[model samples]
Target chain A: MSFVSYLLNGISLGSVYAIIALGYTMVYGIAKMLNFAHGDVIMIGSYVAFVAINSMGLPIPVAILLSVAACTLLGVTIERVAYKPLRHASKLAVLITAIGASYFLQNVALLIFGANTKSFSSVVKMQPIQLAGGQLNITGETIVTVAACIVIMICLMAFMKYSKAGHAMLAVSEDGGAAQLMGINVNGTIALTFAIGSALAAIAGVLLCSAYPSLTPYTGAMPGIKAFVAAVFGGIGSIPGAFIGGILLGVIEILGKAYISSQLADAIVFAVLIIVLVVKPTGLLGKQIQEKV
Target chain B: MKKLSKTTKSSLITYGIVVFAYIFCEIFMRTGHMSSLLKGILVPLCVYVVLAVSLNLTVGILGELSLGHAGFMCVGAFASAVFSKCMMETITVPTLRFALALLVGVVCAGVCGVLIGIPVLRLRGDYLAIVTLAFGEIIKNLVNVIYLGVDSNGFHVSMKDAMSLQMEPDGLVIIKGAQGITGAPTDSNFTIGVVLVLITLVVVTNLVHSRTGRAIMAIRDNRIAAESIGINITKYKILAFSISAALAGAAGVLYAHNLSTLTALPKNFGYNMSIMILVFVVLGGIGSIRGSMIAAVVLTLLPELLRSLNEYRMLIYAVVLIATMIFTWSPSAIGFRERYSPAKLFHKREKGVQ
Candidate 1:
């Protein structure tokens, strides 16, 4: 029963990671660049939601909507101002620029929010569920988080499969030049990807804060990196890969903390990633491309 | 002197600059012209220069992005600090102890580099970058949990807390888990730092212009072509990475020795530091050794320079970072430079003279 509870907790945590990883994987796939700022966008989302609820006296759902809208706009703006100029530049340049953007966002947040850690009020109002004569209790945040993750994942998959914009995204990811030649607006598609990814980031931010209930300028950094690892673990360019990778990573992290030394949990998780990458360089779901002479 | 080669001339200038800076700083200190703040940053400035230059070896010359350079530095720092602590009484001479500790730090970091590189180098591009990042975090996380003590019955280590070490009554705890090592001798100084910086510059600059350096660059330019031309890709990659790691380790030694308490904080040894070093390399101009040194010094000092603006310091720094990237790499900026470059004007003046 305790193991079952741990697994549930892992899934809930993993669900948040998956949501963030989805943003990372999508941006990487479409733009062929890592948006290091994507993590900070999550931080911004949380802050926005926090302000909306606490200061503005807005309802939870309204605050969430506002956060999502703000993040989407911010993502598109970041893409245009910081990233678009580096489209034809080297991957390294784009990465550095993304990093710069990340620092910019973090500093801005720091200046506005100060360095204090805010105890976030949970947005989820659902009642806790008890099982096995109340020995195992699952919090409302966990249920909402897991449910939100699954719903988001399913909707993303279906949208990518059927929507026109999604097909354009697929085409761009496949080959930007070819897609451009085929009359697809590669830039537009990339922006849309950013918009959608940022929206998901906002949701992930809310869920993350609700579960962990702490907010800071750096709240998203570690989780962002972990989700990125998850994205790579499952297979970088694949959607389903991010899901499986996030869940597995979360489970490993939780179980490692439970069974092994909690202090070494992060080490154990990273070590496993190294081993997995050694076994499969492209990642579990990542496609292998032959070198061209 | 008879006309020196371009590489030779550049290398000479680089050495000249370091020596000149050291002499300049020493004179300032003697004349009481340097501020306490500037004086304090002198050693750390050297450390950053070394880090920036060493990381340039991998990111600039070798063309592989490593996000775990700080992990190597952490390994180097903790190894040296541990050694220094354990030998505090046994080793009577500070100089000898410090040198041995330095060697231990370098060797440990280099070995870790090789171990990490062997498996990690198998992956390419972003995959390789991510793996390095993972290794770096792993190193930091593991270091945070480590508990080490030394007594009459040799050394004892435990991943648990300090109490779990079960050392003898007279045992001294060198490392107390998250609390980290305290009381390590401060054997580092601005002079030693500058010397190490010079040493690192010589090694890295020489490697960049050597036959192996050419081979490494060739691999970076075109891996397939280099492999076809009989270049040992795996060997060179590992060699460059490990050497770079060793240099970073040396920087870590300087860093560790300068402080009384040495802890592997994320701010110091995490991916952020690695990224900061990378920023130096990129902003300086990738593959340009002198540029890296200059960039490291300027960027490290910039925040201090902007201390008056306190709240806006990092904000301005970020803006500068973004602006520099755009200026350096954006297509319009490149075109603008080509159109109005000083080199082109100089060439035109020579043509007119002819």
Candidate 2:
């Protein structure tokens, strides 16, 4: 592939990461907890889509809808069951519970699906567009993933800005106690945040699997972690930061693999994280807050 | 006077648990009445015990969450494995070689601990967690790329491939790229593992009771106050973290020597392994040494005991994990524990007798 195609690949991959990071940032913004299980929700969405399309013989669109709806429900249920009780608990406790929920989701997928990688047919079937005298080609999947990510970002921004529910989410995220006092049902907004995040996870899952073309119980794990790193890199809880962070991480990862040693790509990526963290803990675009006594 | 007696009482109980474990393993081994599966897990159970206890030093005592203990273990495993491989011809005695290798592993891992702790410990909370996690990943990845071999001509290092190892015809390959160390001596046994566990317990419990330990806990409980009280925060944090790393390295040596073929697969020393260790620490109740030990041994053996359940084993493990966290940390569970705790009953009995 030419340099252009490689950059395109990175853009496509980064867009998928951005979608996943949105879930993380949304949940973190609203709940003040890292939804570690959010990654596994991607896995769940992919599996649900797989079953709907391949096993149940449903159309691709219906399968996509099923995946999104299932993930939305799963996300809400997880928040209610595992996270709700621990809302007032220690951060460490909530973090561990999130880890537990992540573990639970992965293992349940393993139990149901077994520890095997499943081949997933491309959701978006279109001819690859040849460019630069056939030197550069972009697949339909890549186009769809990138386009859909942009659309989602726009929709999310508009929703957060204009929608009443979105405004409620913003209020809850700012201060749950204050929002509750303002008669904005804190739990409901939090639940809505999870639903929206998980629904995005479904889109990300399908797009990611389409690009990668393989699905395992752990397919979401590395991407999940990388997306989280992206979120952190962009400054956690900032939507645009997540967007830019995801793209930048993706480009760096792709370019590192293309130029540097493939084995060292993950290390290089993490090394960048260390450097960023050491230099600026709040990450790019993150606001600084004074430490309170 | 009561406090002194209470310290003795707790130490006595700690020793009692160790003795009980040793005897139980001994009886199982000598009797041979139990399944081979039980015997097989003894060494691993002990390794997990050491790992859990040492991790408790950072997570529980230091009040910093480190998700990179496995990375330290990985460092120790490879360092010790390389040492043993290099000394294979020179040192004929397996026992002596294993002991020397263990020392080497501890030093290497402890050095890694200090190196990682210095820069990473400056950050706190989630940032610290992710950075340490990154450090762990970096170490794991570096080990995979790093190739070390030993021959009569001495050690040859390479990064690209094994063919870069231009050594004498009989040069022993020690860390092949991704393939890891092979033909390693399996010197780990139930007895040695138990001894390591005891050593870990002694070190950790002593540290927890010492003045340094008090300062460390104080830092964990309230860093600002600890700093105000003139505790050298960085010194104590690094001291606790490196010690924890050193202990994890010791566990790594035990684990590396236990297996004939030690591969640096992500499964062995990756994020998953790190998370699992954290789970042991968290589920055992943060900062509770004995709790970590019990949780480690039980959780390790739980899957093995449930082997007959096959697919249900991990499912059950997940349920138990979530349930344990809920019960241990949930508000309702706190209420339950406060009412029915054995320690409370013991305190009541002592008061009555007085």
Candidate 3:
């Protein structure tokens, strides 16, 4: 029964990672750049949601909508101000700029919120579900997080499959020059991708805070890096891959903590990533790109 | 020959800068004009310079982005500290002991670099960067759990705890898990650090201009072309990476010896530290050795110089970082620079005279 409970908890945690990893994969797929600032955007979104719900006394859904809108605008603004001008710059230059933007966001949060950690009140008000005569328990946050992850994943897949904007995104990701030649708005598609990714990040931030019940400026950084690891684990630029990788990574992390020394759990997770990459260089589902002379 | 080659002139200028800085510092200290705070950072400044120059060999010269430089530094620091701690009694001569400790640090880190690079360098671009990041995290995590001790019955190692080590009653714990190693000999000073910096500059700059350096750069420019030309890609990559790792290890030795307690904290030896070093490399202009050295010194001193601003320090740093990146890399900024560059102006004046 305890083992069953641990697995459930792992899946719940994994769902949060999946949500974050989806943002990373989408951005990387279209832009071909690792928006290192994406994690800090999660921090900003959570703070916005925190302010809206606690200070303004708004409804949870309304707070979430406000947070999403703020993050979407921020995402587009960052892309235009910091990233768009560097479209033809070296990859490292773009990466460093993204890092600078991340530092800027974190510093801003520090100044505004101070260095103290906020105790996030759980937005999920429902009671935990007891199964097998209360031997196993699942919290409402867990159920909501997992269900939200699944719905988002499905919606995203359907969007890419059917929507006109989604088709433009697919075309842009496939080949930016060719897509532009075919009358697709390359820059607009990329901006839409960032907007969508940042909006998902806001939701992920809320769910993450509700589950953890703590909010700090640095909260998103470690998880962000782990989600990036998950993104690469499943196969970067692949949507379904991020989901599977996130779940597997989350499960492995929790199980490692339970069965092995908790201190070694992080090492074990990274080691597994290394082994996976060594055996499958491109990743579990990453397409092998051939070099053209 | 009446004139020096371009590379030689540049190398001479780099060496001249370091010598001039050393002489200036010496004069300031002698005249009682140096602050305690500024004096304290002299050794660390050298450490950063060595780290920046070495990482440039990989990221700049070899054109591979490595996020594990700090991991190698952690390995070197811990290895050298442990060596110094165990031999504190037996090695009566501090200089010889410190030299041997430096050797141990360099070897351990270099070996780990080779071991990691063999598997990691096979991947390219983002995959390679992520793998290095993973390896770095693994190193930090593993070091946090390690427990080591020395006693009359030799050394005892355990992952569980001090009790599990099962050392004799008189055993001395050198490494106390997360507490890390303590009481290592403080045998480093500003002079030794500067000397090491000079050595590193010589080795790295010489390597960058050598045949092997050219081969590495060729691989960086075009791997397929280099491979077609019969250059051994794997060998040069590993060689350059390991050498860079070894120099970072040397910096770690200087860093460890200058401090009383050596702990593997994330701020000192984690992803952030690696990125900080990379920032030095990138901001200095990738592949520009002289620029990396100057950038490391200036950036390290910037925060200290801005101590009056306190709260706004990091914010200003972030803004400056973004502004510098834009100035250096943005298309319009580059065009603006070239249009009014000093060299271009000098050439125009010469053309007018002609």
Candidate 4:
């Protein structure tokens, strides 16, 4: 493939990462905890969509809707059942609980799904767009994924900036105690944050499954981790930073696969993160945090 | 003279584990009713014990969360495997070679620890966790691409295909990229694994009680205060981390030697394995050595014990993990622990004095 095609592939992949990273950054920003189960949420979303389309014989659009709704509910339920009780617990405890929830979700999927990889039908059906007199080609799936990501990013930014619920989320993220004192329901705002994040994970999961064409109980794990790295790379709590980091990481990963060793692409991606973090602990766009004595 | 003392608590627990493990193995061996499946898990159980205890040093004692422990294990496994493969012809005796391989594995893992510690020890909290996670992934992937061969001319290492090794026609391939080291002597057994576990427990417990161990704990409890008190934070951090890595490597050697065919996979030495060890550390209660040992053995054996559950085994394990975390850390549970602490038995004597 030509360099442009490789770059295009990277862009498409990066958009997916950006979408997933948004969920991670948003939840981390508000809840002050890494939702380790976020990836498994994506897995659950894909399974839901798969079941809606193939098993229930639903249309593509309705399948997407059902998947998103299921994910939102799952996200809210997890936060209530697993996370809420540990609200005042140690950081280590909260983190372990998140890991446990992650394993719980994955294992539940494994038991139900039997550790098999299911083929997913693409929701977007269109011919490949040929470029440079058929020397290069790009799938319609790529175009839709990239465009959808851009649209979602813009909508998210606008919602955070203008909407009342968005304002409440921001307030809670800034200071939960202060937000509670100001008549905002802190738990409700946090729950809404999870809902939105889970919905976004669903979108990312669908696009990822469509592009990859195979769905398994663990399909969401690697992408979830990479997106998290992107969020951290751009700045863990910054939405715009997550967007930028996700794209950059995708581009670098694809380019490395093309030019360098394809097998070592993951190592390169992580090495870059280690270097960037060593140089800037808060990430590129993250604000400086001062630890109080 | 028959009465228990405060210091004896740790030794009692330590000796208890060793003695109990010995008796358990003896009973299982002597009895014909025990399943072969349960017998096979003994070595793995001991390996997990060492892993959990070593990981506790970094997570519990040093107060830093490292998610790349499996990387150290991977390093040790490959290092020992390669060393044994190279010395196959030179060392005719299996026992001597296994002992030498263990040393090589421990030292190599320790070196890797120091190397990773230098860059990683600077970061704190979640960032440290992520970096170590990245390191673990990198090591696993790197192992996938590595090609090592042995021949009359000595060792040959390459990243490409076996042909790239450029060895003589009869050269033996040690690590064939993804196919890992093959034909390495399977010298590990329950007895050796138990010895390693005992060594790990003794070393970690001693370090926890020693002055250096206290300094490490101080760093964990409060880094700023530890530094204020003129503690060499870097020295202690590296020391604890390296020691942890070395022990993990020892466990890896045991693991590598036990299996006939060893390959580096995500399920084996990847993120999943790292998280599994961390589960043991966290569930056991941080800073509690005996707690880690008990947690490791129980968690390792839980699935085996629930063999009848079949497919539902992992699901049950997950629930147990979630439940354990919630119970151990929740505030209400704190009340239960305070009231029912093991020291409560001595409360009657204290009440008489009062």
Candidate 5:
């Protein structure tokens, strides 16, 4: 592939990665917990779509929206079931619970979906959008995924910046105790954060199906890890950074695969992480917060 | 004061019991009546015991929630497998080749352990979890591309090839490939495995009970306080990690030699295996060596005891894990309620270091 085409593939992947990264960053910002199960939540989102499109025979758009809704509810339910009870526990306790939640979700998926891989129909276009003298053949799915992610991110940014509920979320993320004292419903905002993050994850899941039709219980593992790298690269709590990092990481990964050995691509991404730590530990686009003693 | 002395004396005697246990295994393996199949079970139990315990060294005693302990094991497994191959191939003297191969494997895995440790030791929370997860994937992928020295498929020789190289005129040595490293000289019977496990147990027990171990535990409890109190948190983290990695490497060496297989199947050692060993740590209670030991044995044997249960084995394991977490790791484990709320537990410990 030529350089322009390489960059284009990178951006297409980057957009999907950015959407997923937002989920990790937002939950981390609010809960200060890694939500190890978030990757599994993405898994749940994919399966939700599988049931909708494959089993229920719903229209593609309806299936996509239902998957997002189901995941949003599931995300909220996870908080109430797993996290709420551990609100005052040690980091290790909560951490383990998150892992437990992850395993629980995966095992349940296995039981429900079986160990076999689920095939999916394109939520977007199966046809490629040919452009620029056959140099660029963007898939209809890629364009929709990129456009949808950009829109959701913009709306999230606007809500956090301007909307009363969104600002309440900001307060809770900044200082849960203080936010509580100021009469904000900290629990509700936290739930809202999970719900929104899960919905976003659902969108990424749908996009993944459009891109790669085979879905397995373990399918979320790679994408989740990559988006997490994006969240860290951009700065864990910085929304804009998550977007920038996610997309940039996707591009680098693809380009690295094309130009360099695929074996070294992962290494190169992590090498970027190691270098970033030496240069700016808080991440690129992230504000440095002082460690509280 | 009395409790400390008794505990110390009991732990010291635990080593004696471990040595005795190995001797018993030696006798059992040599006895004419015992089946090789039984020896297989006993021997693998020893190696896996070391693996689970060494991993517990990081996940349990050190209190670092690493999700890549198996990656360290892979390093150990591959290093040993590759070494055994080179020695058998390069050296004409069969005995010399065997010894060198095992030696090279252990050392290479030890080095790999240290290399992966540097960037990750200071990381905390789920970043460590995710990074280790990434590290595991990277290792698994790297193994896939190693070309295992050729075969009928091509130039990748596997554990199968290495095993075939080990020969005995008296008909003692045996080897096999993905068929499962069949002829490995069968040197890795129960006694050797048990002896290695004992050595690992001793090293890990000593390390966790040392001052460095205390520092690790302290760091896990309160990072800022431990650092302020002059604990070199990062140093101890790396120290624990490297040592634990070395121990897991040792186990992998024992596993390959005993099984007599040179197969490089990354699929076997995965995130689930890491999680399974971690379940041993948590089910037994983290920060407790005795807990790790007891949990390792039970977790290892539980699947065997459930042979009749078969497919339900994983389901049972999953259920047991979920229940354990709900019972022990959850805030509700202490019976938190809406009337008092979970946050009250914090106020009670507010004067204490977080």
Candidate 6:
């Protein structure tokens, strides 16, 4: 593949990771709990899409909306059920709960849907776009998918940066107690954070399904880790940083496929993550804050 | 909690596990058909106890959530399989082969544990979780690619005629390509597994009760405070990790020998196993050794009990796990704190209480 092709692929794939990552980073930023189930939210989103498309027989647009809606609701359900009760528990317990939720989701998906891989049939695959050279050929699905991700991400970023709800989220994430004292409903902001992250995960599921049609119960597993890595790479709590990190990670992974042994490709991505963590745990855009003794 | 000598407590748990195993085997014989199913459940139960306890050392005791025990188990499984296969020709005794295989597996896993532990020791909090998760994927992926076949087909003896077998000294039998190692002696019995699990429980319990274990739990409670008091955080983390790895290695051997069919699949040792084992530790309550064993057995038996649910087994598990997580998490639930807590149990009450 050409460098441009690699870059395009990286940015597109990375955006999906960034979308999934935003959920992880924001939750971690606010709660200091690793939501292992966040990855499974993407899995759940794909299933919601499966239900909307297969069972409901809704229009593609309606199906996407339904998936996103279901994901948002489920996100809140998780917070309420798994997280809300554990707020006062040791942070490790919350983390363990998240893992339990993650395993629970994947297993449930397996039992309900069967372990066989499902493919989302597409009418968009036939239309292939020809680039300037014969060397590069992009499909219609890829184009729409990438473009949709960029637009959704921009909207999400805007919502976080300017909206009152977003500012409240920022305040609560910074200091939940202080934010509560300042008349901000910290719990409400957290629920909103989950909602936004979940909605993005649903979008990511749709895009991933389009790019790679097969959807397994565990499909979100790898991307979950990679996106979190991306989030960490850019700065765990930073939205734009997640975007940049995701794209950069995607590009590196793809380019490594060509320049390095593909067998070690995944390892290299994580190796870089470790190196980055060792050098700067707070990440590029994140400022270091000393934990209060 | 009353105080008992470490050696005595260890012996008690060990003997208790052995007696429990005999009774369990009696129940298995009483359950009638589907003996394989019973064995399957028993095997994983025994194995998972070790895995959960080993993982608890890191996630529970060491104050780091490392999701890589499955990776170490993978190392153990492969190492055990290789060791047994290599010894197949030289060691004709089936039982001895099994014993040696497990021994080799545990050692290999322990070495790998230490190797991986070095860099990860520096990490703490969720950063440790992410790094361990990454390391797990790396190990699994690497194993998926690396394989060495058994040189059983008479060593090809100068690559004789293309269509012919190279005989002369020995018979032709070849280890297949990434086809999975098969036909190992059925060396893993329920008794062996229970013994190992019991041994692991005792060893781990003793370690946890030891000064080292207390130091680990203290670190888990408050890293800075523990460090301030002169606890070598990284050293204890590594020690706990290596022990965890060794236990997981022993479990891997059990899994490999009992299952017979072995393949290098990353997916097998993937995040799900890690998470499942962690749930066992969490559900049982971290820092509680007996709790770890109980949770492991319960979670292990749960899927079996739900077998009647057929396809709904996992859905039921999800419900059960979620419900239990909620139940344990609720502040009103008294023992819930005891079950899921990773903190040190000791408390220095106020002067007025005395």
DockQ per candidate? 0.84, 0.72, 0.82, 0.72, 0.28, 0.51
Candidate 1 chain A: worst 10 consecutive residues by lDDT? A259-268
lDDT of 2 by residue, B1-354 (tens): 455667657876987898897997798778887788787888888889999999999999999988888999999998998888777788999889989999999999999999989999998877788888898899999999988877898889998898889989998778888888898888889889988999899999998999999999999989899899899999999999999999999999999999988887788899889888988888888888899999898889899989999888877887787777678667887898998899998999999999
lDDT tens digits, residues B153-266, model 5?
A: 333333323444433333222223333333343345555666677777788887877888888888878888998999987788888888888877777777676655555454
In model 1, residue pairs whose N, Cα or C atoms come closer than 3 Å (at least 3 residues apart or on different chains), thus clashing, are none
4 against 6, candidate with superior TM-score: 4
Comparing 2 and 3 on DockQ, the stronger one: 3
| Distance from true location, Cα of B69 in model 4, Å | 0.5
Better of 3 and 5 by DockQ: 3
Clash counts for the predictions, in order: 0, 0, 0, 0, 18, 1
TM-score for each candidate, following the candidate numbering: 0.97, 0.95, 0.98, 0.95, 0.82, 0.87
lDDT of 2 by residue, A1-293 (tens): 67778789899999999999999999998898888888899999999999999999999999999999999999999998898878888887788788888888988999899888899998998899998789889999889999999999999999999999999998998889999999999988999999999999999999999999899888989999899989988888899989988988888888888888899989998999899989998888777777776
Fnat of candidate 1: 0.84
lDDT of 4 by residue, B250-279 (tens): 999999989877889998899889989998
lDDT at B259 for candidate 2? 93
> What's the lDDT for residue A278 in model 1?
97
- Write the residue-wise lDDT of candidate 5 on A1-293 in tens digits: 37877787788788888999999899989998877777777888888888888889988889888989988999999888878877766666666677677767777788778889888777775678777788777778777877887898899899899999889988998889999999999999999999999898898988877778888877776788788889988989889999999888988888888887675677667666656754676678977667787
lDDT of each: 0.93, 0.90, 0.92, 0.91, 0.73, 0.78
Candidate 1 lDDT score relative to the true structure: 0.93
Colliding pairs, model 3: none
Residue ranges of candidate 5 with Cα displaced over 4 Å: B1-4, B13-44, B59-63, B88-103, B122-124, B147-186, B214-235, B258-266, B307-312, B336-354
- First chain TM-score in every candidate? 0.99, 0.98, 0.98, 0.97, 0.96, 0.94
Among these predictions, the greatest DockQ belongs to: 1
Candidate 4, residues A194-237, lDDT tens digits: the string is 99999999999999999998988888889989999999999998
Computed on C-alpha atoms, the DockQ of candidate 4 is 0.72
Per-residue C-alpha lDDT of model 3 across residues A60-161, encoded as one tens digit per residue: 999999999999999999998898888889999888899899899999999999989998887788899999999989999999999999999999999999
lDDT of 6 by residue, A173-210 (tens): 88889999999988888888888888888988888777
